[model samples]
Target: MRNVKVIVQGGPANEEVRTLPAHKKNPEVGDKKTVFSSHLLMEQADAESFGDNEEITAMDWGNAFVRNKKTNPATGKIESLDLELHLEGDFKKTSKKVHWLSAPTDAHPLIPVVLIDYDYLINKKKIEDGDDFTACLNPVTEYRVNALADANVEHLKRFDIIQFERKGFYICQGTKDAEGRMEFGFIPE
Candidate 1:
């Protein structure tokens, strides 16, 4: 079997679908075999807890929320619904798509890649007539994460642009360095 590095981008912050817990055990999630399953990549413990529970219904790609369950005075729920919630299952239905790269092996080796992300240089969205531009400057604007890219990245030279699926487009910084590190700068969408 080919070892693929599945990068799950957008999803609810709930622990059920977290990579730390869920994808750790089953790495083949979102693959062709179980791409359309409602409970794709759900943690074993959480799936067991929800055994036959009627309050919460697992929707596409293991996302779940309480619909109409009534329990006494009940605690409040913070409803944070992302517009991209349906991005996981049924390729025909989801707007966003998940990207995967081949894992490194003797036969099919992958390149070591660094993805650089950036936030706005300014903290304020709009500058009014008398707004102080210096004060509104954002202190932290750059973020970087290490990733493994498919072997095809080796052909990319400096300034080559490539889209990282749901992550957005990125420009190649340069060829692999002395440490075999290929860097890409994220271009804001």
Candidate 2:
């Protein structure tokens, strides 16, 4: 049970909103989670930024409900509300430092990326050009590039969530994809 406050400016913006309860639990497998939320304050100029064929990046704000709150019919009492929290944008343009992969060669330039997942965190050495990586719907809160390389995987297993600095908060999906890749998602905060 954590509390989060969010504010957005320079776009379809809103005044500061406060005291929202973040109570939703992370969603399980096969769940269609709402990964992004916020009051979209799109101005004509902002809308126009998305020119016919180009991709435009923008910061978005919204609340994330990890799980839905439901009441027990028999007890006539509210059981638990789904985990929810405030989320702010963490995309490359809005982030203070953009994340990129160093070129395989020492002299080549680096390449920028929009999303990264657990596989990148666990096995940075094995990532190849065609490897598919996936992240949780929620953003991660904290992470280090070589966490597993330095620590015991079993010891870190107890925590359900991890914060990826400059990335976002992530919750483990506890499942693997068709290619046996670990799947996780982020909830921006």
Off by over 4 Å in 2: 1-96, 101-159
Candidate 1 lDDT, 15-67, residue by residue in tens: 23122211334555322211221112222223223322122323324323222
Q: Give the TM-score of each candidate.
A: 0.46, 0.22
Task: In model 1, state the lDDT of residue 31.
Answer: 22
Q: Pick the candidate with the highest lDDT.
A: 1
RMSD of 2: 21.5
The candidate that wins on TM-score is: 1
State the TM-score for model 2: 0.22
